[model samples]
Structure formats: C-alpha cells, structure tokens
Target chain A: MMTATRTKNTTTVELEGDRVVVIARTFRAPPRHVFDAWTKPELVARWWAPKSHGVTVKSIDADVEIGGRYRYVLSHGDNEFAFSGEYVEIDRPGRLVYTQVFEAFPDQPTTITVTFEEEDGLTRMVSREVYASAEARTAALESGMESGMRETMDQLDELVAELAAG
Target chain B: MVETFAALAEPNRFRIVELLRSGPRPVNTIGERLALRQPQVSKHLKVLKAAGLVEVEPRAQQRFYALRPEPLRRLDDWLDRYRQLWDERFDAMDEVLEELTQKEDEG
Candidate 1:
C-alpha cells in the first residue's frame, strides 16, 4: 500500500504503482477556463513560478498543439532552472498529455497527463506523471532536496499548512 | 535520507517497517506476522538499523525493535516540499483562472 499524504486543504499526492505519481486538486472554475490558464503563456506566467517560493518567472513559451514544445524557466536569485517539454496529445478543455524534461536531468523525461472535469462550474484537475522508473521518480521528487533547502521541520510544517490553507 | 529511501525500497523490508509502525515487537513476532524466516528478518533489521530506521531495545530476556522516527520525519518533509512546489503553482493558477473568468464576464 502506498502512503499518500493530503495537504489538509489543497493538493493530494499519491505514489501510484512503481513509476507514477498522481497529484490532484479541484478549483472553483470551468474546465475550459482552467485549460486556458494552463496553455496560455501569459496566464502560465501568472501561476507557474510562484513568488512566495522565492522564484520568479524568467520566460515561458507554450506551443499548445500536438508536436509543439513548451519551455519554462524560473529563477531564484542568481540561479535559474528550466523545464521544457513537447506535447504528445491535446484535447482542449478535457485532457492534455505532454512529455517534460527538466534541464537538470534532461536524459530522463516524465510524461504528464492532465485531465479537467467540471461539475457545477468547478474544475477538478488531476495530473498523472509517469517516470522512467521507480528510482527515477524518487530522484525527480528529491530534486528539491538536492537544491539544499534545509528548513527546520516546524518551519516546514507551518509553511506547508499555510500553503495548503490559503 | 537517500539511504533511508534505498533501505525501504525492498518489499520485504518495507513490510517490516509497516509492521513496526503499530508498535515495537520482537524478531520472532515480526517473522511470524510477516511469514518470513527468523534469519531473513534479522538480515532486514540489520540493514534497517544501519540506515538508522530501526532501533533495538533489550527488554529483559527479549529484544524489542521499533522505528527511529527522525529519518522517517525527514523523508516526510522531503515529500512535503515536492507537494508544496506544485501546490503553490496550483494555488496561483486558481487566481489566474479567477481573473480570466472575471475578464470574460466583463467583456
């Protein structure tokens, strides 16, 4: 049994099988608008690189079509990290399947499949990421750890709760 | 922390850790519950101990094995960071969606 942790009020993350991670959340908006916010570069900039995490959007280029590519860069002070990917499938307002490669580990790419379901004008967004292997999935998840984030557990707990709550 | 992950990656060891979660128990008890041989249980416990995941305590004639929470807590913290990274973006996306909808309503 995989132990999945829910963020109290926000995202619920599950480690599915051996090489997949499923993250899900619901938003109070229609699916088409939610899909637009993800595909449109300008709106992606408004959300992708969160300022609260000390990261700012450097640039974003999302070509929202089959065979098209997208790249996003986020900078934290003097350091910048980039993730680029190609679209594998597209079903507007319902589904998007893309292959993503973080520049840090360009050799191993993860395929991300996102689905949007609308009920009562609320969109439930679920992202399923399939990695090369179980070890690769763990490595990708541990990338933040490698970046030298050493916040005390109490501080982390508080920050996580705040993010999940607000 | 990476060592902790590697140690728990093995299915038998993972099951041992799960069994230990309820409370401390002797090696024989663990073997019986998990249906593994006593020697195999000892081997897994040694690896877990080296990884600082399990600790043994001598209680009179029997020894009790229990989880060492520190390493597990750190692992939990790491997973939280991964979750937080995406949650932050999703929360921001919520705002972006709101603005987009509001603009459409206005126009």
Candidate 2:
C-alpha cells in the first residue's frame, strides 16, 4: 500500500503504486488566477525552471487548445533541454491533462493531469504524472528530469556520518 | 527508503558508499580500496544501484562508480528535493498568479 508519509511541507510529492508521482502545492490566489498563470505563455516562462538550476528559458510556444501543442526550451550552459507535449483536455480554472515528452526520453511520453481547486480564497493545485513503467519513473527521477540537480559530495558525508552515529 | 537502508546496512556496502564520497572509482579500485573481493564488490554495487544509492559514471574510456547524494537513506528525502525543484517553479508561478489576481481586481 506504500503507507510511509513524511511530514507535510509547502509542497507534497507522493509516489503511488509504482508508476505515478503526485505533486500538490497551494497558492494564495483564486483558481482562475492560478490557472491563467499556467496557460499564459509569458507567465509559464516565469516559472517553468528553477533558478538554482541556472537554466534560462530560451523559448515557449503554445496553442492552448484541444490537441494543441506546447513546447518549452531551456538552456543550461551549452546544453539545451526541451519538453514538448500535446494538450489532451483543458478545463479552464479546474482541470487540464497533457502528455509530456522530454527529448532525453523521446520514446516515453508521460501523461500529466493537473487540477486546481479553490477554498477560502486559496487555490490548491494537484498534478499527477504517470510513467510508462516503474523503471521509467526511476530513470526520470535519477536523471532529475533535468541536469545539475543532485546534491553535493558534502551532503553524502553528512548522510554517512548520521548513519555512523547510530 | 527502506531499500536505501537495507542496501547500506551491510558493512561492506556502507564502506563502499563512504569510499565513493571522495569521487568516482572503477570497480577494481573499489575492490582494492575497500579490501573486498571483486565478487563482493559487484554484489554490493548491484544492491546500491537498485536502491538508487550509486551510479556508473562512465568516462570516455572506462566506467567509474560514484555516490548518488540526493537518493540518500530516506527516499522521501530525495522526493523532497525533487518536489523542491517543483516548489521553486511553483513559487515563481505564485508571482505570476499574484500579478494575474492584481489585474483581475483592478479590472
């Protein structure tokens, strides 16, 4: 049943069964605003990649319609990674579904379903990504879905030191 | 997470992980430095790989093994790191949402 649960934080990432990752985060805005932020090309450019990765958003192209395609290109150093997908379903301010394919794994396209709910002026967004198999999920995670994500060697020292103290 | 602990629970595997902290090493080098037989080294490495604790860093000519820092003793620990990557993006989304909310209010 995979019952282990960690202390809740601002965002929750959960593994269900073996092939899906469920991610949820809350925003202090209405669902419409949150939904618009995701659909708008300029807005997606603002948040698709984390700053720590040091990757710049090179370009974003989208049609935002049924079966419409969206592509985001990010560049890190001399390397460029692109995520492109076609819209499966789009229910504005509530639910959206799509397929995402990273250039690294061209053969495997992940189905991602996201929903936004509003409660007391806040919006909670939950997104689930279903992979082709457990192994595919693990590989995507091992590769960090992007580069420059693994922790530093010093963190390894801390992990081992903590184990030795026991 | 339990997988990670089980892989590292073995004294040899734990030492291999510790040895890898310095940098990547070829399989024979791991065997030599850890004072373990080659078969034992391969066995421990297989477990670690399954547990997501280490990976092969193959250079142009040879393959070297290295410690995977993010996938630590706790699976949730790395899950948190992964989600934190999303959190960073969502945090940025927060800014966009804020601007949208402001526009709606003004309109």
Candidate 3:
C-alpha cells in the first residue's frame, strides 16, 4: 500500500495480491467543469500527459456513442504513446465504459470504466481499470500510475477553473 | 501496449519509430535508411503489422508502411485516469503563483 497527497486530496494505491486499486479525490472544482474538461479533446490536451511530458494529438474522433471509437496519441518528449478503443457503454455527463489498447502491446488490452457525480457543484470522478491478468494490472500500477495521476489531477483542478472563468 | 513497446524495444524497431516521428514513409525507403536487408526489414514489419502499430498501403506491386495512431489512442484512454491528478497539481501551483503576483501588485 502506498499513499500520496495532491494539492488538496489524498490518494491511496493498494496492491491486493495482483489486483491494484487506486482511489483519489480532490475538493476544489465543480463536477461539470471537470467532466467537460475530460470529454473535450482541447481541454484534455492542456492537462494531459505527465508533468514533464507534452501530448500532441495526431487526431481526435469521438462521437460519445455506445459503439463509437476514440483514438489519440501522447508524446513524452521524443517518444510517442498511442492508444485507441471502442466504447462499450456511454451514459454521457455521468458514466462511460471503454476498452483501451496500448500501442506498445497490441495483444494486451484493458477496460476502463469512469463515473462522474456532482456534489455541491464539485465533480468527483472515479475510474476503474481491469486488466486481462493480475500481473499485467500490477505492472501498470507500479509503472508510475500514482505519480502520473497526482500530476494530472492537479492540472485538472486548474483547467476547470480556467474554463469556467473563460 | 505490449506489442508497441515490444516493437519499440528492438533497436531496429526503435529506428522505425524514429522514422515515423517525422512522418510516415514507405517500407522500402525505411529499409534503405536503416541499411537493413529487405527480408529482415520485412520480418520486423511482420511483427509490427500484427501489433497494429504500423499500417500497410498497397499501390500496385509496392507497399507503403505508415504509422497508424489508433493504438496510441488506446494507451491514452488507459492513462486518462491520471489526467485529473496533473490538473489538480498544476491548478494549485497556479493559485500559488497568482497569490504571489497579487501580493506584488499590492506592494
């Protein structure tokens, strides 16, 4: 088990044998802005990628449909990271389920489920990822998932404020 | 991500990625640039093809290999869980900077 603190949130990542669960929450922005910042490609690019990396989207095609496909890329300096997937379910402005394939390993794919809820105008988004194997999931969590997320959520808080103010 | 990473793990595979970084190119051209034997390059390409990291376009008898970005999108989706973390941290930093600037203004 490992614990990390963001600007105003506490995150705990625990490895239960091989299954890893990461839970974090921040208190400072409205849920709508957070959700919008997530769903919008432009807003996403601003705060996407790790703190030391810049993400350049080669293309973005999202319809927000149940069977729609979303594809994009992220570059960390000179290295390019590719990913794409089809939406299994979409309850817009609320929840989403999709399969993500990492360009690095085409044979391995993971499923991501996200939910957004409003509390006093602040949005709480929770994401759960299930991998094909326990070892694979552990590899992901150990591979900078905590530090990467700490930086991303921090940027997200700012993006929400900026979009709202704009 | 395994296939893409595995493809990138090899020196030759990394060469291919570096080439595509500028833009897509023909496999023959890529082979020439890397000085790799045509058969060897084709074999490496076979692995990449199975990974969906590279796409092939046929023009008559010749084929062109282009970096298709769909797989990267899949990686990004998985990485999206961290998007909020960076946003929150940067947002706080901005607040600290703003407060400092405001104090300077008051002074």
Candidate 4:
C-alpha cells in the first residue's frame, strides 16, 4: 500500500502504481464554485502559477467541455513556458478528464482527472495525473540529484534485505 | 540520463538491479536466483554497467556485480521535483479558494 504525504489544509499526495500521482484536498467552498475555479480561465490564471517562483501567467484559453481544449502560457523573466490539454470528459460540478502536454517537452503527455464531491458544506477534490511511464515522470524534473541520495540508498538496502530474508 | 533510463527499462535488467540491492552477487548466483541463464544475466549486467547503474569487482576468480547509487539517486531526485511542483500548485489553489469564499461571504 502506498502512503500519502499530507500537508497543510488537509491536502494529501500519493504515488499510485508507478506512474500516477493522486492528490486530494478539501475546500470550504461548495462543489460548483470549486469546479468553476478550475474550468474558468480567469480563475485558473489567478492561482495556477507558484507565487514565490516569480512566474506569471501570461494568458489562458479554456473551453471547459468534452473534446474542448485549454492552453496556458506562463513567463519567468524572459523565458516563456506553455502547456495545453484537451478535455476527454466533463461532468459539471463533479468530474473532469483531460490530456495535458507541456509544450517544451512534447514527447510524454499525461492524462489528468479531477473529481469533486460535496460533503456537508465543503467540497472534496481529487486530482489524479497518469504519466506515460515512470521514466517520463522522472524525466520531467530534468536536473539536480545531489541531496537525498544517501537516504534513498539506505532505504533501498533495507528493502532489499527484507525481501531477500522473506 | 537517457542511457540510464533505456538500460533500466528492460524488465530483466530492472530485476537485476533490485536483486543487487541486497548486496553484491556473482553472475552465476544472480542467474540462479532470477532463474535466468548465465549468458542472459551477463548481458543484462553489461547493459547495467554501461549505464553506470552497476559495477563489477573481481575477487580472486569471481566478479561480483553491485548496484551503483548515483543513477538511482538521480532518478529519485528527478521524481522529487514532480512531487514539489504539485504541492506548490495545490497550496496556491487553496489560497485562491479561501479568498473566493471570503468574497462570497462579504457580498
């Protein structure tokens, strides 16, 4: 069983199988409002970019329906990054499915599904990202492997020892 | 990096890496444990060695193959970036939702 790492605001992130990342979070807003925040381009532009990174959302084009497409461009100083996706499924205030591809790295595209469930007055949202492969997921990072290597090596050793003994 | 991914992508080679994680093992021992032929095991080891994911050490007449930590470490660090990216995005989304809820309550 995979363990989910929980963060503030009750957000949980877990690796599903080898190539899927599942993230779940509960918001105080209703399901409709929460769903709208994702489907509306203006709302997405307001919150999608990581604030501390100094990345600004340059433009957003969203058509929130089945077979519709969405595109977003972000800029960090002189460098511009673009990502686009096509909707596969759309169930208002409930579910959404899309294929997402980063323009810079078009080789591996990921499929993402978002589901919203209403509990009491709060909205529970779950997003699942399925990568083409484990290699594709790792390749997305592109650089830096200095820290955390020793700890991972130690864990691998322990896991191997346990497997061998069992 | 592409070489490492290509080398490790093979099922047999990946299993060998996992097996070597316990400790170094001679070619014949790895073959026996994995039910693979000696030649097959050697082929996989050659690929792994070429990719720098494994190294061989000669002791007397035998050569023991052990997993190299560097490539695996690089893979782990690469995956960490995706994890961090999602975390940051979700955090920002939470802030947005909170602000929107506040606006709705006021109006």
Return the TM-scores of chain A for each candidate in numbered order.
Answer: 0.81, 0.81, 0.70, 0.79
Model 4 agreement with the true structure over B59-86: per-residue lDDT tens digits: 8899999899998886665555444545
Quote the true-contact fraction of every model.
0.59, 0.60, 0.03, 0.38
Higher-scoring candidate on DockQ, 1 or 3:
1
Q: In model 2, which runs have C-alpha deviations exceeding 4 angstroms?
A: A1-9, A145-166, B1-72
- Order the candidates by DockQ, highest first: 1, 2, 4, 3
| Structural similarity to truth (TM-score) of each candidate | 0.77, 0.65, 0.48, 0.68
Provide the clashing-pair count of each candidate structure: 0, 0, 46, 0
RMSD of each: 7.4, 13.8, 18.1, 10.2
Tell me the tens digit of each residue's lDDT in model 2 across A1-166: 2267533329888876667788898888889888878877888889876677666788888889999998877765656667788899999999999888775566777888989999888888898888776666665554443233344443322221111100
Model 3 misplaced stretches (Cα beyond 4 Å): A1-7, A14-17, A53-60, A145-166, B1-107
CAPRI verdict (incorrect, acceptable, medium, high) for model 2: acceptable
Which scores greater on DockQ, model 3 or model 4? 4
Candidate 3, B1-107: lDDT as tens digits = 65654565577876786787677677778889999988888898888888898888887777888787886665555445444444544464334434434555599
Best by lDDT: 1
Question: What DockQ does each listed candidate score?
Answer: 0.42, 0.26, 0.03, 0.22
After superposition, candidate 4 runs with Cα above 4 Å error: A1-37, A78-80, A92-95, A103-110, A113-139, A143-166, B98-107
Name the weakest run of 10 consecutive residues (lDDT summed) in model 1 chain A.
Answer: A157-166
- Rank by lDDT (best first): 1, 2, 4, 3
- Candidate 3 B-chain TM-score: 0.64
| Over 4 Å off, model 1 | A1-9, A16-19, A76-80, A133-139, A143-166, B104-107
CAPRI-wise, candidate 3 is: incorrect
Ranking by TM-score: 1, 4, 2, 3
TM-score of chain B of each: 0.85, 0.66, 0.64, 0.84
Which wins on TM-score, candidate 3 or candidate 4? 4
